[model samples]
Target: MRRDQSPFLLANPRRVHAAPWETREPDQAVTVVGDFDTALTEVELHGRWDPHLKASAAHVLRTCLVGQPAGIIADLHDLADPGGESAPLWCAAHTWGAHTPSLVPVVVCLPTAAPLAALITCRAARWNLPVYASLPEARAALRSRAPRTDRLTLHLAPDIDALPLVTQTIGEACAAWHMLTLHRTACAVLTELVANAIEHAGTRIDVAVTRRPSGLHLAVQDHDPRLPHLAGAVPGDPGDSERHGYGLRLVHTSVTAWGALPTRTGKIVWAVLTAKSAGERNRRRPSTIPGTTAPRRS
Candidate 1:
């Protein structure tokens, strides 16, 4: 069957395949062999759950989380040595997912008779992570618990006109999602991201606006590989025009969390905005970029 015609993509048309990661020993590699659907992402793992394999698995899971899927189904039935030692990995992933603004859920799939089944269940129970005996069961459980999410995607050229269009889109998304409280902040953060892409990348930009239970999720993708960094200006200082770098500073202050992820063609700058009172919003500041392992801070 054609790659795009696969059942996974058929069920969720918005899903896309991500490049798979492999280890030095091909047989021991862990691969993300599923589509990245907004509602759920399925990650299938093979080979032993050794230290080296665990590192690759962690990276794969981290990348999947960056997409902000509503839930994740990790299928480890094919793993040669899915022992209890790797239980901590799933727990850590569950913790990471819980920390996201949307609180993405994660479930595992392994045979009931597998050696790691009981051990994983005991360890994962502390974090409330679920383990199913089959892929169908895991998928069903995750889908049942997945939060409602709405998304809008737009592709535009690297031009100034895209700014107003982006603003309009965010406004519509917020209104439709009944998240008017986040409309203003969402517009501000997304505008900065798109403006930066248009100014620096000078390439086509892909914009995504997603509404989650917490608030809004915004991402801008451009064909420029260069990641963004914050300016050296003081927190409250408005520097001279030549020294000005407040564009991202405004975004950093307005959103709950923000980070950059590199893609094959370019990079994606994403941010999450949670509903908060004006006083709380004013006092909020980002300590460290979350979701991705090596994210560029703004």
Candidate 2:
């Protein structure tokens, strides 16, 4: 870590967080602060924990609730766990519940199997905390919460040029969080998707962007009538000669929430960067492009 870097920043890559915490050190980095008006009291995720980055997110949550009894209202309604690895979730939830009596954790997960439910059953049984299936139900119980705000969506061509286009578009609109790493990540993802669309899906691509109260939304469309799956940022098929195959890995790694949506043509791959990350992504685009040998631009 640099003398100027925060100790809490990711020192090594953890399997938990995909690639958002990919780099050993980004040119610009921010300690994610959950904002209640201002990140005064909020959950801040640090480092990488695979399927979910919430592993260390309890830090800000605990800090925010210190001395103050008013707890936070967390929404885990849309959370997806593919690996069946619940350690991180259990760690984040159970540990937080134990530490903060003032900070109430609203468990908002979708209905799960009896086995899966068993994992979180302890939370409800012990804390008497309400576990809701949707955000609406959870919102009704919380005392301090705001109604969901409007969503801003952007749809565009999946042209190779789309990277610069979308980068500039998102950079300008979401100027509040101007982290260049976000743009770089977006640019990298766009490059891969558009390339895949052109090569495998028969070009004819589409992309959309939306800014919801919770985060910024991005959707890319194509006409090949095919579906894409999450793959390692580094391709396991070493024999593969595909160019930029690892793009989606970073896309998956960078945002808070992301996935693919079925479309009439192919599919729309989307991702969301939380509003909390605005300040982080907007910090500054790195002068030197990652992995390049050239010096940074002045």
Candidate 3:
């Protein structure tokens, strides 16, 4: 019989039997195995639990989640903590949740009916983290969620001249996704965002666009931690057309939704443009009309 040649079946094949890359210390070990099929970074932890254990796990997890994979499979079946404390485990979960661009879905595997399992379950409820008894089960959970594809990441200097190039890059993605109708609206939102980053922060900015089933999600990362909110400015008159404050206001009016989050290094401002019927954008009203308030960061 011919073996399956599907990449899904063969992802990261060379590393199938490879020893997991490990981070070791006197009291603990955290090993990570890449399972590319599900875009999961499989991590296994073993040893005593302590405040330091949490910090060590955070450090290791930062490395594992570098590319912002779809999800994480954390195996704690070998963990040797007898005290049944879940704080150290939750620390890693918190770090994974706090990641910018997007939070990583974490599926934790622990022994069935183990003391630690109960402890983790109790706290997991508060954070909505998933706990499973086996690796296969954890994989199933990740598989059930909708997949998001990373379309592109572009780094540009803080220059207004880059605006056209940025819009062109966005146009390409919109065309490929069959969302050509959104091109105009997307360009407007992106131009406003990029211009704001360059003017206020004056640092190199990174822009990432991801395609989702519902829409295209755009994120602009800057060195400034300060978040931007939609200004009260409205382009109801000629004077407002040239105002600097209209940038975010245009963002609020054009995109379906927008928000901001702080990263370890800086901050990421994100917006989503809902897929719309051809020419539907022309009929949409400004987001600040009448009783409506400007979009606020969630």
Candidate 2 C-alpha error for residue 147, in Å: 9.9
lDDT of 3: 0.61
State the displacement of the C-alpha of residue 176, model 3, in Å, after optimal TM-score superposition: 1.5
| Sort by TM-score, top down from the best | 1, 3, 2
Going through the candidates in the order shown, the clash numbers are: 0, 28, 0
Q: Residues 191-244, candidate 1, lDDT per residue (tens digit)?
A: 878888888899999898987767777878888766676556555645454246
- lDDT winner: 1
What lDDT would each prediction earn against the true structure?
0.67, 0.41, 0.61
Q: What is the C-alpha lDDT profile of model 2 across 1-298, one tens digit per residue?
A: 3422222111111122221322342322213222221111223223323433443334433432331212344444333444335434544654464464333443433455534344555655554444445444544555344333333334445444444555555555455544343554444444455555655665655554444434454555665544555443345755452333444444444455454423333455555555344334335333322321211110
- How well does candidate 3 match the true structure in TM-score terms? 0.51
Compare candidates 1 and 2 on lDDT and give the better one. 1
Which residue pairs collide, candidate 1? Answer: none
lDDT of 3 by residue, 1-298 (tens): 1122111110110111111222345647665554323445676777766666655566555544433546777788888766677545555565664563456776778886778777767776676667789999888888788365756778989887777777778878887888876767777777777878888888889887777555676777788766665345446776654564666656655665565544555566666677652135456653332211112211
Listing every candidate in turn, what is its Cα RMSD in Å to the true structure after a full C-alpha superposition? 10.4, 13.9, 15.2
Off by over 4 Å in 2: 1-158, 176-187, 190-192, 232-244, 275-298
